[model samples]
Target: MADDFKVTDPRTLRAYAHPLRVRLIGLLRSEGPMTATRAAAALDDNVPNCSFHLRQLAKYGFAERVPGADARERPWRATARTTSWDDDSDDPAMRAATDQLNSVLLGVFTQRAQDYLATRADEPAEWRAAAGFGDMLVHVTAAELRELTEQIEALASRFDDRAADPAARPAGSRPIQLIQLAIPRGPVS
Candidate 1:
């Protein structure tokens, strides 16, 4: 699978902005290939709903059918490990689509955090202690801010291989969601 799926078309971005579609792509990317029925069960969703969404995702090139021994069972796989778009697009449609995608992503991130919090008490002590929920406010120019984000991404990429290959995961390894945001606290000049 490709490492990054860069969306340039607004329609493609909008197509991938749906919550279910986003989650479905994530499932395929992280867990390897599976049929739509299996994906639906994993996501706690129905077959038809997921089947249609999976087709839509395939139409947008976010997913594709994986060849298997059984012709009837067509497994779907994500085209890339991560889906991203250029937030600095000059096109109005691209900007609008990016905004929509970002909004959906923010909702997903919020829900994940809330879900974790709900069962945090039941988690292992080490995991509970390791979970992070902290942010820092720093003063930096736009260039410096960009540099900082790049540095953080580089660090995170060190673990990228583990996601695609479950065998590479060490014992006691569990999925962790790491969200990063660098919003300007004040109005821009």
Candidate 2:
């Protein structure tokens, strides 16, 4: 899969802003390629519905069918490990599309967090200890904050290969979402 899918067109952004499509892309990224039927089973939805959304995703180049399979059973795979767009776009249309996509993503992230909390007690001690929320407040200029973001991204990229290569992951490893958010808590001084 490609490293990143950078969406610049507002139409494409709006197309990808749907919750189901977002979740489908996430599934493809985390679990590697799978047929629409399998994706539907994992997401607790129907094959026809999933297949439709997968086609929609493909319309904008977010996903593609894998080779070596017949039409009915061909697996669909994400074109990128991550989807990114400019939230700071000057174009109003672009900004609106970005906001819509972010809104859908935030809901997904929140639900995932809640799901983890609900099942935390049943998880292994090691996982429970390793997983939890964390936050930090810092004072920094825009340049410094940019630098910090780059640093964190670089560190995370170390594990990017593991997403596509199951063998690269060590034993007991599983897909983990690491969200990084750095926003101004108050107006700039």
Candidate 2 structure quality by residue, lDDT tens digits, 1-189: 778899999999999988899999999988888999899999999999999999999999999999787866789999998898887889999989998988888888888899899999999999999999999999999899989999998998899778778889999888888977777898879
Q: Give the residue spans of candidate 1 off by over 4 A.
A: none
lDDT of 1 at 183: 86
lDDT of each: 0.89, 0.91
> What TM-score would you give candidate 2 relative to the actual structure?
0.95
Residue 25 of model 1, lDDT score: 90
**Segments of candidate 2 deviating more than 4 angstroms:** none
Clashes of each: 0, 0
| Clash pairs, model 1 backbone | none
lDDT of 1 by residue, 60-178 (tens): 99999986537888899999888878899899999999999999989888887998899999998999899959989999998999999999999988988788677889998988778
Error of 1 at 53 (Å): 0.5
Question: Which one wins on lDDT?
Answer: 2
